[model samples]
Target: MHEQLKQQLEHAQAGDRGALARLISVLESGGSDAAILERCLRARHGGGYTVGITGAPGAGKSTLVSALLGEVLAEPGRVALLAVDPSSPLSRGALLGDRVRMQPHAGSPDVFIRSMASRGHLGGLAMATRSARRLLEACGWPLTLIETVGVGQVELDVASATDTVVVVLNPGWGDEVQANKAGLMEVADIFVINKADKAGLDATRRDLEGALASLPPERRPQVLETIATEGKGAAALWQAIRDHRAAITASGELEQRRLAQVRSELKGMMDALLANQVQRLFEGQDAHARVLAVSEGSLDIATASDQMLDLLYDQAAGRV
Candidate 1:
């Protein structure tokens, strides 16, 4: 680790807000700068609870998160929000429009709000989401809220990364079918039927209940109702989240989930790094020659794959 990098990381670990921001920028730009990440990981008390709020578009996820932010601000601790927005396809840029909806608490020192674009990433999360979470964790924020890009099925992946997954649903928008789907149902720790002030709230609740009834009691997630825009039922939602956490803890499932998440993240990072390295190595190379050989029956796809793997392994091992 360079002295300067170490200092920046140390400052972040020491709760220097500015240093923490800079560390996040470095990670967002794809710079490994492993020393900083290592320090941040080590400094992590892992005390924070990351709550993921996700659902279909127009389900009032943003409003729910904004209201929840307000509720969390009233408490006696730091809180951070990571709002993930869908990226523009042509420009491959994320507009982060949700931040505009959260302008009321923008200047609060105890609250940190960040708008992250998905950058056309497949997982419905920002490219630097993991690192961003680490940065927030390093900054002494005891709670982190991740508002995922609500793109239907893919949003389920967002749940695996959080301590608790809250799937916010609207009253009449395919509520039953969404809940019955394997992906969303499996990932939901708690279900929030937001916009409960509207009609069909009971129907939505029944739909969710019926779907959950088929699952084993131990696998069922608690369901809550919220009129997020008016801040109604927010306390009950919060209490439900806490109770869910307590249940997971008592069942010894929280540690298992954490370990699984860590392993998944590590594997994803390694896979991306390896793929990038392989692409760089083979760029503008004689791939045509290999293809031609394979076409002519002189080479096999398995052999080609093995060759590529060998090259990648060698490069990773510093033997290239």
Candidate 2:
């Protein structure tokens, strides 16, 4: 399996889309094979820039992403989009709304669009998103876009994971409380008012501006308006994104952001790995006996847990 994945990685780096898709699938269903692939590709990763788009449901994020694809693809390089969707409770599969909405780019070789199931992961991203983005980077994509599964608030993880985060809102957004309540104001690198042709556009802009007034002038996110369905203002939005990237890169903030993201992702992966180990320990026969002993009052919870930890330590040390 390791050799097979290495071959797949080589082909993917050589522009084989099918191979790349297969590699992404392997990472999505993570295990030893995924770890092996990560080890193989670690040195080659970190070439691409990731931008995240997030907002509340019905904010027209998908439409805006579709419009932005045109602007991104007008350049010479390949671009990848990872559109996160809510997982189906029964099937644990992507809902596919984002993919369906992005059907226009389905046949474009220069554009790679994938819908990922959130798979019960929190903060609007699946565990595989990090791996998939790294894989795309290793395969030489210059730009990657992640459209998060925008639940109401608490989508700030995307902001941490991506280089730039664009938060979308509609015209009546001004009627709501401060954007910070939704946690959008804290994470947004750029604020986009989509569906700007609707009523209350001016009020919403004023509200957004007023809220941003407290922020340092240089740190305030640029506010752009767009009617995504008509493909209006996408160019301006793209240019704003480019400008943000340029500013961050010039100030050396881009490298700092990437380093912090790497540290955060590494910590997350460690926590996940430890959790899996603990889960396996709980599922073991020894754990079953320990549970029975505790239920029968023959053993205390603390002692049983300590015994399990000892067993785990022995296994880790190759003594079990």
**TM-score top scorer:** 2
lDDT score for candidate 2 against the true structure: 0.81
Q: Write the per-residue lDDT of candidate 2 for residues 1-320, one digit (tens) a residue.
A: 88899999999999999999998877766668878887876632446898999877778998899999989888778889988665564564434667778988879999998777544332224457877888899999999998876634335675558899998888887433244434787778999999999999999899889989999999999999999999999999999999999999999998888888888887877777778788898898999999999999999999999999899888878998
Task: For each candidate in turn, give its C-alpha RMSD to the true structure in angstroms.
Answer: 3.1, 3.1
The alpha-carbon lDDT assigned to residue 224 of candidate 1 equals 86
TM-score, candidate 2, is: 0.88
Model 2 pairs whose backbones collide: none
**What does candidate 1's lDDT look like per residue over 229-276, in tens digits?**
798978888778878889988999888888887777777766666666
State the displacement of the C-alpha of residue 279, model 1, in Å, after optimal TM-score superposition: 1.2
TM-score of each: 0.87, 0.88
The TM-score, computed over Cα atoms with residue i paired to residue i, of candidate 1 is: 0.87
Q: Give lDDT for model 1.
A: 0.73
Report lDDT (CA) for all predictions. 0.73, 0.81
